[model samples]
Target: MKRHSIQTYRRIIQITVAITFIILPLLNQLGFTFIWGNFLNIHIGDLTLSDPLAVLQVTLKNQYFSPRLLMSAGIILIIAMCFGTIFCSWICPFGLLSELVHGLAKRVLPNTFKKLNFQISGFKIKIYILSLGLIFFFLFCTRPIINQLSMPLWYSQIFQYLFIQKHISFAVLFVAVILFAEFISRNRLWCRYICPQSFLLVIAKLLNPFHLKVGYRKEKCIGNKNNNPCQKACSLSLDPRTLNNLLETECNNCGDCIVACKKLGKALNFQFSRHFS
Candidate 1:
């Protein structure tokens, strides 16, 4: 196998492990719980890695906030900055669905794929404000109102409102819009714009070791700059050649760029740090 294909295999394993950690409990197969089999859990070898979903629940519950939770949140945020949306790319169920939508969109609308920027600046501006509110609500309110009330979290109403399919809240409605938008756009808009989790991850990932990078051979990358299909093919639609270009943290490193480079036969390919191996 080629060097890059080997790296891809490693990444797949990493993601599978992470997703399994989150998925097992929902099946009642993990065999432990926080309170009398109510809150399902497991111990990782000896030390519990903490149920990722439970950890998320604790983060959203004002009652569960602690120095430990804060510390964990910090750690998660740091990781996100480096890998950006590793959770979405690798683990999230909804994210997997979004990826399917993206594949279908690419097939159905090849020219429109990644051509339109669904990223609204006003929406970007609100993420900071929303993040601040979550922090404040976690610290001061009766519930971590903003966090629990997050649009993505609302989907759990699928189980939360299991028996009685009642009316949806504003947050749920917002989540529905995001889901609908996934069908309408190339990449899922919710993952790109509104997810506070990705926001935290972006922070963590930025300071960590490395990012999905192209071995940029400028001599080769320059071709049809005015109508660069490589940039147009990017879900984030970012120009890869500009001097200060790594600003787009929404990249899931799905290898679309790799395929684009190959499509145009551009002299570019992914490079990973030795640590990732």
Candidate 2:
């Protein structure tokens, strides 16, 4: 029997989550109230799961803390601490869509267009955006305004609006526009640079140095230093061989590079250690 790659399992989980959200709203409409709410705040019976950034924004805006909300968000943060933002690669519907769009763009666009150099670090830009948005919201907004920028929330809410309200949300067009822009640029601009929601996950992952991450063993590597298949396999254009500090923060443990390296030299792998080698 042929063993499936990590990406195959990741895609299964991603597709399952995407389909589950679409069906959840329909089930709620049909009078099943066991599971409710969108990705920003979801409840399954007595348990709740929420976006940590949304929870933080609400706590800041209201000057109050809800233990329930904190606990819900903590669950997600703990997962990030252990697995390094696997939420983006394994479960987010918008992520799955973005990856698909990026794949299509790479196939259709010219090679020259795909090689544009981005001098600014994407993670730093995300932190800057997160900081500026929080500062602006803290001074000027009354509500959890940052929640408005969550693509995963919007993705889930689209199904909620359609199934429960029988209304089409403009968010469909919003997400489509972002995907279209990414396709044209041959880049995952939103996931890579713009999404503020992921910053919390990145921070959580950073807090724990022993969290699961890609480890590259240079001795095991047999590929060229500059032009390796593992590097080419990265959708985010990251070189697995050099995932240190800021560069590591951008990796979601998607395992594409590991899979790409498996046949060649098996140099890359998932490990729970501080050292990359």
TM-score for each candidate, following the candidate numbering: 0.62, 0.96
Q: Candidate 2 deviates by what RMSD?
A: 1.4
Local accuracy of candidate 2 as per-residue lDDT tens digits, 183-254: 888777898899988999999999999999999899999999675999888888788887666467899999
Residues 1-277, model 1: lDDT tens digits: 6555433664575556445434434533334444111112223443333223335546667355776556535544555555555655555545655556666777787674554464354236446766676567667765434444333344433433432334444544565566667766665566666555455555455565565544556777655757576666555555555423243455556555556676565655665452322
The deviation in Å at residue 256 for candidate 1 is: 2.2
Clashes of 1: 11
Worst 10 residues of 1 by lDDT: 34-43
Residue 228, candidate 2: Cα error in Å is: 1.0
The whole-model lDDT of each prediction reads 0.51, 0.89
